[model samples]
Target: MSLLLAAPILIPLTAAVLCVLAWRHRTLQRGISIAGAAGLLASAVALFQQVSASGPVASQMGNWPAPFGITLVADTLACIMLLINGFLAVCIVLFSLGGIGQRREAGGYHALVHGMLAAVSGAFVTGDIFNLYVWFEVMLMASFVLMTLGGQRGQLEGATKYVTLSLISSMLFLSGVGVLYAVTGTLNMADLAVKFAAVENSALAVSLGLLFFVSFGIKAAVFPMFFWLPASYQTPPPVIAALFAGLLSKVGIYAIIRTFTLIFSHEPQMVYTIMLAVSGLTMVIGVFGAAVQTEIRRILAFHSVSQIGYMLMGLAVTGAAVADGLPGGSVAAGASASASTSAVNAAIPEFAVMALAGTVLFLVHHAIVKTNLFLVGGIVLKLRGTTVLARLGDLYLTRPWLAVLFMVTAMSLAGVPVATGFWAKLVLVRAGLAGGEWIIVAAALGTGVLTLYSMTKIWSEAFWKVTPDAADLAAAGQHPTDEAIDAADIGPRGVPIMMTVVAVMAVATVALGVLAGPCYRVAERAARELLEPQAYIRAVLGPTAGRPASASEPAPAAASAGGVPSQR
Candidate 1:
């Protein structure tokens, strides 16, 4: 069981080391990268199956007990995330083989890719807050290197902004950890949860919670904090951008969900209200931003922010249910009641479950679809030689299959019927209406309309319009770079490697949409575990994990306490 839990992190780290060692041999490095990705995928699948059959799984390093040693855990949510990461790693590695230019490959690109994968896997599985912080740093370091690999002017500029913002987020996270430790004196998340519940200082706890909220909000690319994403994501290679779009921000969302649900399950009213307001603003701003962008990758980057709003909506609903004393648990003590609270409380559990399940469903569906869309953009760049909409056209005539693939993924993104995104949106909208969250429902619907509009703009400019000649491009003050010209001259033989990887993802997107039932069942189970985290708590800290300290009782000393020590 421990091996299964460790496999996802270990495989990637080992592969990264091997890739670095074989850096002088590009062929060996490439082979190692492929093998590592495949190994990760296999390990993730096994872990998911084991967790499914036998509740949540946990392992303490060096045979040490919980709260005293490093711990790795795999609840349903973590397993689902690991599975997605594994799949993306494979597709992105293959895509990079064909899409990343030779200059970047020679600069330890494969090694960096594996390192990032290791960090992502570690983040998903670790049970300690400080361990999560370490993994975030690892991910940030690898991504910074990858972003600046080619040293192009645009790449360097983007990396500077990315690194600057990311470092700030890391510092805030560490500071939050410090403050939280002062209040609770534990770095283990399960242990912290018990201690936080017993703390007497409401103001201090709330302040620390907000600190985490701000730190993760920046990483999740929530509205008002998402400007850095659009400015920088478009500048990286499309494969890197796709991976970032699909996985990076989602990790932040994962952290938000985990902390809110498992650790800060108390004080639902404040948490839910904040999440709801931020989600609405995020959706509105992201779609509006996408509407105005002409570059393909930039538009997609903005859409990533919008999609995050939907996931956050699910989380907000979950918080509301808890506040209303729904099926998952009770409202926090001293929570003030309002006149309409009774009415809202009447329909809590059903809608809350729907919202959470919808979020999981949407998360998986969007990751596959969004990643495919970016890969398609890379294909466009490969054939048309640039991503500027006005400078390129007529892809439908030249490559109808690519156009069809784009239409499928784009429509799926827009939540068109029979597409996976449509069902995801439907569930959330229904949940919102059921809970009387009219503003959220309206924001969701409005965002979908604008998303379709943006997709149509891309379709019209890049596929329907005639391809601009060199003279026309020069007239418009748009000169294709020498690399772009060379890319355009390449024929069908140049596309097969990239095309195969994209086709697989496209098929998976359709499969998820067409076969939503089975996937929703899995998501439903994951949501159940999230909403009621006893299984997760026990897995990390043993059966006695939930025992809280009495108000008059002092906490156990840190060195002697078993699992989570109670608050003093």
Candidate 2:
């Protein structure tokens, strides 16, 4: 399990090095990169097996114990995320094979993709807060490179804005870490959990929490912080944009969940109310933006922001429930109410557990389907040489498989029944209802319908419409698109073999639909582990029973007395 945990980080790093060193040989670099992706997939499988049999796995790097040195902890949550990351990496590599040709800087592309993989996988597994910041920087750097790979005027403009905003976020994240270390005196997440157990209600805690929230919320593209995403994402190629759409923002959501559950669980009222308000607005505004966009990619990007709102809705509702249960809260509002009783204790964790689990599942499902859709868009571009809905039409006549792929993805995104998306929406909405948040439930369901509307609009314009005007093609300085009269070669027939394999893996979309029950089980277990992080704390702080002294203090005399002892 430990070896498998290391592989997600190491395989990418190793492959990146090989790609850079063998830059002159594009084929060799590509081969190494593909093998690394396969290794990551195999490693994820191995890690999942160990987790299923033996529960969570923990590894301390370089013989240094937790707190003092880096620790990689692979609970069900981390492992599940690793699996998604691995799967997406492999699929994206396959998509890029033909899309980014030998003439391009294949090595640079491979290096950046692998580097981003390593960063995301590391962030999922890291036990230390500072380590998380490091991973964030690494991920941002790689993404910046990939964004600018084509070096077109639009890409350069987009990359500049993207990199600038990301750098500001990173600096804010660092500042938050600085404050956290000063207050709690530990960077190890588990160690800090113990160290700050008593301070979660303090003014400093809320202030620091907001700093961290802003940093991650910006990355997650939640509400007001999301302008950068739509602006920059539309500039990248569909393949890269698809990966970003599916994976990047999810990282921010993950961080928000992690911090709130593990570190700020103490002050539910103040922290939670704000979260709920923001989440509601995020969904409302994001979907409306999608409604207005005519461009295919812009609508998808806006939708990304909106779906993030759903995840936060679950979290906010759960937080509110938990808040009501906190000591000296509104539970005593009525004379008949018992002061000792908490409405939150009765239902909060269950709602939170279910909501978070659903969110993660949704993320995994979205990544694959979204990537397939983007790549399919690329295929459409290649065949018809245009993405604008106004210009492109009659795809169903020529590229039926691409049309089929689009329907599957669009239906999945639309939350149709018997699909993985339905399951995700079911979990999220049920969670909202369980928490008594009817407004959120209505919004979520309404968003699902709106999503369908937007998707169907594209379907009508792009595939169902009459054949495109060859005149538009001539206006755009391109050859008139032939009606894909041939069936076999209709959808990218002459494209590289690897692209075909990638398109085939879109079958996972339907497979996940079929396996929703078991996957939900995984998500539930992962969420349970995340909410009750005693195991993580124990791994970091030597099985201590109570919170540790401040970070500046020497190790507790008896390691077990505190939550976990730093082995380092």
lDDT (0 to 1) per candidate: 0.82, 0.74
- Clashing residue pairs in all predictions, respectively, total 0, 6
lDDT (Cα, tens digit) per residue for candidate 1, span 1-568:
7788999999999999999899799989999999999999999999999999988988877666777778898998899999999999999999888777667788898999999999999999999999999999999999988877777777788888888888999999999999888877678886776667666566666677778888888888998788889877887778888888888898999998888776776654676888899999999999999999988988999999999999999989877876776332233332221113343336348778889989888889888999999999888877656889988799889888888889989999999988789999999999899888999999999999999999999999999899878788788885435231234334444478888888888788888888888888898899888866667767777665554431122432322245433210
Give the Å error, residue 42, model 2. 1.1
lDDT of 2 by residue, 52-132 (tens): 776666767775655677778777877877898888888888777755534345438888888899999898888888999
Candidate 2: count the clashes. 6
Candidate 2 C-alpha error for residue 398, in Å: 0.2
Residue pairs with colliding backbones in model 2 are 541-564, 541-565, 542-564, 542-565, 544-562, 544-563
- Residue 11's C-alpha lDDT in candidate 1? 99
How good is model 1 by TM-score?
0.92
